[model samples]
Every structure is written in C-alpha cells, then in structure tokens.
Target: MKKIEIFSHNPVLLKECVEGLEIKPEGTYVDATVGGAGHSIEIARKLESGKLFAFDRDPDAVLVSKKRLSSYPAFVINSNFCEMKKRLESRGIREVDGILIDLGVSSYQLDNPKRGFSYRHDGALDMRMSKQGVTAAEIVNKFSEEELIEILKKYGQERFARSIAANIVKRRSQKLIQTTLDLANIIKFSIPAKFRRNKNPCKKSFQAIRIAVNGELESLEIGLEASFDLLKAGGRLLVITFHSLEDRLVKQKYKIWSRGCVCPPKSPICVCGNVPLAKLVNKKAIRPSDLEIATNPRSKSAKLRILEKL
Candidate 1:
C-alpha cells in the first residue's frame, strides 16, 4: 500500500470524489480530467492489478499527471475527456469500472498569467484549455454584441449581460480588447458600482468567455454519454462541476439516464420500453464541506454527482 505524494494543487471535492468511485482494487478506472494529477495519483495508488487511464486536454496537465502517476499503473493521454471512448477503444479497453470527471479550469491555469484563465491576472485574453482554437480575446472582439450577450447570460448567468455585451462591442470598436484585464475593466464598468461590492464583478464575464473559448459544455454533453456507454453494469460515473451551468447539464442528463419509462400520465403499459440505464448514487449533488471551502476557496462552488450503471 504505497502512497503517491507528488502534487502541489489540492483537487476540489477530493474526499467525496474518491469515495464516490467506490474503487475496486482490481477494477479498471479512468480519470477523465486529470488536472494537476491530484485525483489521478490517489486513484492510481488505490489500484492493485487494475489500470488507470488519465486524460487531459492541456498538454501541461498531461505531463504533470504522467509524472505524478509514474509509480502506479497509469497511462496519461494528452486529449480531451470527450474522446475517452475512442482513445480507450484504441487501447483495446471496452469497459471500465469507474470514470471520474473533475470539471473547470485547474489552479495552475488560473494562477498562471500565460493561460489567461484568471480575472485577477493581467495577461493575454487567451483562455483555451488546450491552448488552441479561438481565444477569449477573439470572442470578445469579433463576436457580435448579441452573441456576447447570449454567452454571458447562458454560460455566466450574468445579469448584466446586455450592458456588458454593449460595452465590449463599444470598446472593441474603439480599440481591440487585447488583454484579460482590458476585458475585465470593461465588464466592471458596465455593471453598476453598487452591484460590485466585495466580490469581483468580472468573474461571470471571465467564466462565460472562457467556456465559449473552450467549448466545455458541448464536450461535457458528449463525454457523459460516451462514459456511460463505456461503463460496465454497476460501474460508477462521478462528475465534479464548478458552476451551476455545468451542474445543471450534468443533473438533467443524469435524470434522463435514470428514468425508466416515458409513458404519459394515464397510459401505463411500458410501451416506450425505456429501461433506466443508470441510477443516481446520491439523490442530491454532493457539495464540499465548510472546512473544505475554508481550506480551498476555489472549491466553494464545486458540486459532485455520482451515478451508477443499472
């Protein structure tokens, strides 16, 4: 029973996520988003004859996870979790005992100025998790005001979406909003000063832009289905989301999967034949404890949900 202790970042909902998996020492597992390898190392350490496959979109995370899980039987893949099924099939793996997805940007990305994920940091407005594709800057500058409003409202749940979108368009028309702070300042001014109290007013806008740049929601939608299809009977799927939007998507998807029949109110003959594919392990989403939030403020918004294949 050796330990893996080569990580600097504290993974959100660590205890809850690991416990939710209900690891079988000899069962195969996958860490769908092995950011910083904090969760990977723990899962790998628990494995005996079982194998661990860790995946991350960011090459940096892939490298870190590989190093951390080196002592254990783990393979780190430099790809998004949405490709889990294809990548696993390529490795001749058809079914897995458990799959864990820890969503949202890692602390490394948020702390690094080069990644442009943090509202606190002043850097290029590039928020691509894979460091590829359209940047947050491009979304802010090139996207129409309506497009900006939609993303801010949908992804960020921002109340000042219209004002912020208008301001972004106005600012970009005058000057190409180049940096993260450049956009942050625009967002801050757009929102009323009274609404901007102790908390940062730019957080929502930053999240919306980052999500748009990364295509996170779409990936999650696909990844969940792929993961469930790859799960063996009684196998578990655990997801830790950092925002309400991601959590809502996960919740609704899980609810759909857990449903047994689609018949109307009066007619009950099991005509649809929709047997439940999975059952919710926890009736409600698991949230981090108060102590956990005290220790890691970044985890305050995290919600963990577990579902087992039926």
Candidate 2:
C-alpha cells in the first residue's frame, strides 16, 4: 500500500467555514468530510477542552487526517459521514456544537491518476471514494442505456445525456469500456464538435458516473439530516458544496428548516404547528474570494451555506 503523504490542499472558503461554525473553545465539533484535514486542522487548533470527530469513507483520507490531526484532540473515523449519528451515539456523543461538511472531491483524489476521478486521467474506471463496493467500470459496463441516461441527466444535468448514453451502449457492444480515457473519448465523440470546443464533453458524463458509483448525493442527503439531528440547539451546520446540484439541495433544506409554517398561503390558522428548527447564517451562499479563485482554480465553483439550530 502506497502511503499518501500529506499534500497541500487549499480548503475552499476556509475562513468562512470556520467562522460559520462559531467555534467555542470547549464545544464538541465534527468535520464530516475531513478530506486531507484541511478544515479539520483549523477546527482542531481552536479547541481547548473540546473534541473533533473527523469522518471520511476513504481509507487514504482517514490515514492522512489521523496523522495531521494527531496533535489535536481529534478522533478520526474511517466511515461515511452519513453514519455519523450512529457512530457518535456508540461513542456516547448525542449532540455536537458544530459540524462542517466540505462536499468536494479532494485535490489529492483528482491529481492522482490511479484514483480515476478526473476525466483528464486515463486510469481504470474506479471512482470509489472508499476504494470498496461498486466501481465506475461496473456501472459503465452493466447499466442499461436508459439507466445511464437517467444518471447523467439527474446527477450531472447533462443536456446531451441521451446521446452520451446511446454512445456508451454502442461502444460497449464492440469493446468493454475499461478505463477513464475510454469512456471520456466515447463521451467526447457523442456530443457535437461545437459543444466539444466550448467545454470538455466528458465532464458531465464522468461526474454522473462517479456520483452513481459512489452514491454521493444519496449519502449527502442522509449525512445532512444526520448532522442536523446531531447538532445541539444553537449549534451550527456549515456545508461547502462544489456544484449547483449539491448547493441546491443544501439551500432547499436550509429554507425548509428556517421556515416556521407548513400551512398553505390561504390558511388563516396555523393548523400544522410546524415551527422553525433552524435559521440560515447567511441569506445567500458565500463564494470564494477572487484571490482564492485565482490561486486555486478548483475553488471557483465552491459555495458555502450555513444554518444554526434554533
């Protein structure tokens, strides 16, 4: 096993995430997606008697975080953050003061060709965050054309989902799509020449396949709820999402939590008795500073949304 060295990863909106948490020196905190311990280290540093629970499905990330956070009062867990509630319960932790979730693929993963996350890479089609369960190759080869289309359209919001799906099926009929470049080429050719020139046609298709393989969105949905439920009253949940899809989910959930009424607009009385559970820390999502974007281009799409339990 190749030990992953602690490579530098610029945590997107680091200041915003930390400030949103409003860290109390003696309050418990959780870094749900502690990729490379970028945000975890900062949270750990601010703790006096408090503890930080860092969770990551990727074993490599867990190893890196464990080392990076060794100096602080942090517990590194090699499990999906969706299971955070149960895991924390096992440790006799019912609620935490704050939670931070950075829902972006780490630069380490993308830069490593063997991980097969980037469309720019030409490695095996294995985009598993945990390095376990179904690989991207299995989904690419076994899923039906319609299934592929649905994943691409729903997850990636790809306009050329139908064409991409058809091409994938057609190509797999002749030869198995075994590598990242293989599928990237198929996706590139599936779209028109003009579109290809505008942007990488494989971007959306690769993203869709990676999401499906890893169940990224499903896990995020579950993790968000778990994190919210585990937060003490007045506790904050700060999430940094990389794409519009993830941001939309976070925004809608925050809106629902911050709203007090469920009754229709025509209702004269509050029959449902639904009270607001949380309030948004910021009315709008926070974006990276221009300097940060220029220095780290990957942070360009990042958006941070925060909510505090009421």
Q: Which ranges of candidate 2 are over 4 A from the true structure?
A: 264-268
Model 1 clash pairs?
none
**In the order shown, what is each candidate's alpha-carbon RMSD?**
3.4, 1.4
Candidate achieving the largest lDDT: 2
Task: Give the RMSD in angstroms, all C-alphas superposed, for model 2.
Answer: 1.4
Tens-place lDDT per residue, model 2, 52-164, is 99999999999888888999999999999999999999999999999999996899888787899988978998999999999999999999989998999998999999998
Q: What lDDT is reached at residue 222 by model 1?
A: 95
Q: How accurate locally is residue 266 in candidate 1, as Cα lDDT from 0 to 100?
A: 89
Worst 10 residues of 1 by lDDT: 1-10
* Cα-lDDT of candidate 2: 0.91
lDDT of every model, 2 decimals: 0.90, 0.91
Model 2: weakest 10-residue lDDT segment is 1-10
TM accuracy, model 1: 0.95
